[model samples]
Target: MFLLSSLLCALAGHVSAFLVETSSLTDLYPPLWKECPGQFSDYRVENGVYTINPWLYPERMGMYKILVTFTAEYFERFAPNNEANILWGLPLQHGWQYETGRLADPTDETKCGRENGNHTCISVDSWWACMNYYLSVLPFFGAIEAGVLGISSDQVQLLPPPKDQMYFCYSVTTCRSTFPETMTKWSTFFQQAMEPSKSWDDLLKYLWDAHVASIEEGRTSFDDRSLYFPKPETDFGKSWATAMNYIAAIRFETTLQNVTKFQKALPPRLLKPDDPPYFIEDFTDSQNRFLFLLHGLNKMHNDSGHKFLSLFRNLMKSELLRKMANTVLEQIILDDNISPQELDIIFSGYI
Candidate 1:
């Protein structure tokens, strides 16, 4: 019977279709799956119904079926236990195994904000909330990138950046030369933006101040060279500046929220509890900050024609997606008897 149950679980991993319902507006981050190679084939929400393409169609050569049911409260309270057992049960499954966190017990009086949202009342730790926040902003970036690049909105593909475009990460050819030039210059400038040997709080302060300064500087530069790109007919420089500021500001706010959440209560697995303890203490507060800073600097690099956007592109292509999944798993095994490294391998090798 256990074997049969396991087989059923295995066969049921391909949940290409699902109906997710939540109580409030904020409780609306739908479950998602992404196995497709090129396209943003993972998560798309339309008309309040989310679709996660398992990418099991053409490759697997048959229709596959799996059950994905999410209630925001259930996800918050029991995600860790459910994810660990389910993922362990069927390592060969096709969807992501998420293990979200809990604040206290499910029946606690806190009630939090959203009726169906996380019990913790903390915003960032709520996986569904974070996902919703990101999904909301993606369209804005899509619109702006299109107008600035002088291409149709559809031309700006978000995830798995087009296979054809020359990239520093996914493409072996581009990384050899193009990437280094872009990344090196940006890294050097970014280091200057930071004060040497500062605490996380200090570092964050530095970042916020530097970014505000950069925005002012960027505005001036735009005023000076406003005549260069996209010809005078389209007013592309003004559009680009507006779009760039929107992107930068959004990134800063999101990064600040994310950093604050992870610092408060990141899963123990992401940081080895056994390792010096302070290392985890220092980093839980600071890890994702670098990525945001990297992204902001990359934006400046592209706008300035520094070519460093290529390095950022490469890093995303190779590492970002995997890193995100690893983070999800990290929370599950926190302070538990599991080898995170081995589990990462199992995750990478299997689903």
Candidate 2:
């Protein structure tokens, strides 16, 4: 009787761990599994192993969402069938941190690197670091693209292109080495904007205004020049100058609701050079930088953008918000019978 009781307890523990380990995967796809219980019949199980049949679901979004939500272990289960799938699959399973192998424990000072002998660590994994890196690299690509299209450096400097900063020309000119200082300023701005009481609508409005202001600054710079006209010899020069005027006019004619419509109406040829795919294979820094911008834009347009931003704002204040925003429930849902106390303990980490 004693041996049988011990055996039952061990089996129960094993089952609990299994549920905990797999809960993360299920939490991400609650729409297909949790929300609609009978829909899981679409997936096939063979030898206790589950496999997704691509033919069963004609929509690519479903497959793509699964790829994105899968953990590193789950990703390995699906042997990559093609290079395109591999490219998409890797990022979904593992975010940017995968290259680093682990996320730096922010609480542990030893894990972080100090900046210029400062005691406080400057985390390279922060959003600020990523943004700064992209800003710094944009000039190099801008110069290269200008040269390729036979557009002069002066022409490039006169316009604030997408992914390029408002003061990019100034940075490349008088204060080429002030990237660190600029990054610090941006970091402070983000920190302030993400305060719990800050208004989300106001923040988004400010961003839109800043974007419009940059375009106006570029146009003003272009107009101030003695030679404002593009050379007739090069198609790029004419098209670029024309596009700048169109972009400026767009701000006045369109409202926020019509922004998507305006974007769709723009000539595809004018936007080709700025596309992420064009720069993906250029350099490691450039690739990651472009990908970050692309991902950020997508997130902003997605339905969860407001909720995600709101959750992030409350990250330091509310433990519950942090858990939901960071998807911590997966790690905490360890057993079928979890007490409220246990749930609180799991979520009480750091924040």
Judged by TM-score, which candidate is best?
Answer: 2
lDDT of the candidates, in the order given? 0.29, 0.31
Which pairs in model 2 have colliding backbones?
Answer: none
lDDT of 1 by residue, 1-351 (tens): 999999888666633222121122113211222332222222364543323321112111111111111111122232321221111111111111122322111223344323465322322222222222122122222222223212232322222211222211222222224333323332232343232443433323333333333334335322433322223211322333333333332222222123333323322222222433222344433332222232344445656674444444344343444355336423542323433334445444332
For model 2, the superposed segments whose C-alpha errors exceed 4 Å read 1-189, 223-262, 270-351
Model 1 TM-score is: 0.19
Which runs in model 1 stand beyond 4 Å of their true positions? 1-173, 185-242, 246-251, 256-351
